[model samples]
Target: MKIIISEIPKEGLDVKLKEKVESENISSTVIAQLRIEKLEIEVIVSGDLAAEVKLECSRCLKDFNSKLMIPVNVVYHPVEELKGEDNYEVRHEELDMDFYSGEELNLSNLLKEQLMLNMPMKPLCADLCKGICPVCGKDLNIDKCTCTITKTDPRFEGLKKLLK
Candidate 1:
C-alpha cells in the first residue's frame, strides 16, 4: 500500500486497512490505522495497529491466543534527499524512517516489519506450569507418577548417613 507523496495534497492522508500476516508458527489478522502528516518532502506516519495471533505455549505446546498492539511513527523522504549521504542517523522526530526510490510508499514492507517486531520470543500460558514428565510424558500438574524419586549419586551416601 504505497501512497504517492504528491497525491497527499497539503492537509494529510488518513488510511485504515485490514490485513493478514503469516509467520513460521503463527498467523495474525491485523487492523492498521494510519495518519500521514506531510512536512515538505517528508511524511510522518502515526498510527495504532492491533492483531490477534495464535501461538503455542512453551511449556505444554498447547495453542493459545495472543493479542498484540503496535504503535508506529515513521518519517519518509524522497530518494533525492539521500543522494549524497551514505550514512544517516534517525532523529527523535523521525519514526519508521525511509527514503523512497519513487513517489509511492511501500506500505506492505513496513507493515511486515512492525508485525515481526511485536512477536513474542517465548510465549507461556501460565508462569508456574508444571511441564510434562521426562519418563512417562504425563502432565505433572494433572496426576502423580508411580516412578520413585531418588538421588543416584554414591558420593552423596556419606552425606545421607550424616543426616541420619
Candidate 2:
C-alpha cells in the first residue's frame, strides 16, 4: 500500500486493510487501520495492527501459533529537512520519527516493521515446559525418560573428598 503525499486530503485519510503478508513468521491474514495525518511539513501514521504469528517454543523447540497485537504510531519527516537541521542527532522525543526521501509512503514496510516488533524474543508453548531430557534426548513433555541422571560434574570429584 503506497500513498502519494499530494493525494492526501486536508482532513487526513483513514484506511482499513486486511491483506496477506508474505512472511515465514507472520500469518496470511493481517488486519490493520492507518490514520494518515498530513501535517504542514510531516506525516503522522498511527493505528493498530493484529495477526497470528508462527513461533517456536524456546524451551522444548516445538512449533506454535500466537496472536500478536502491535500499535503503530510514527512520524515521517522529509529527509531534506533533517539534513538542513544542525548536527545530525535525534532528540529523545523524536525517537519514533522516521525520514522519507520520496513523495510516496510505503505501508508494506511499515506493516513488516510492526510485525517484527510484535514477535516475542523467546517464545514459549507453556510456562512450565520440562523441555528435552539431557540424557536420552527425549521430549520430557510427552513421556519421562527411565535414565537416572546425575547432574554433578566429574571435574569436582576431588572436592567431594575434602568435604568428608
lDDT, candidate 1, 56-126, per-residue tens: 77776777788889998878777787778889656645456766777788776667778888788878766
Cα RMSDs of all predictions?
5.6, 6.6
- Give the best candidate by TM-score: 2
lDDT values of the candidates? 0.77, 0.80
Cα lDDT tens digits for candidate 2, 1-164: 88898789999999998867767656646789989989887888888988877788887899987888888888888888876668766543643687777898888877887787678998889889888877788889999676633556766757875888
Off by over 4 Å in 2: 23-28, 88-95, 147-164
The residue pairs found clashing in candidate 2 are none
- Point out the worst 10-residue segment of candidate 2 by lDDT: 87-96
Best by lDDT: 2
| lDDT of model number 1 | 0.77
Clashes of each: 2, 0
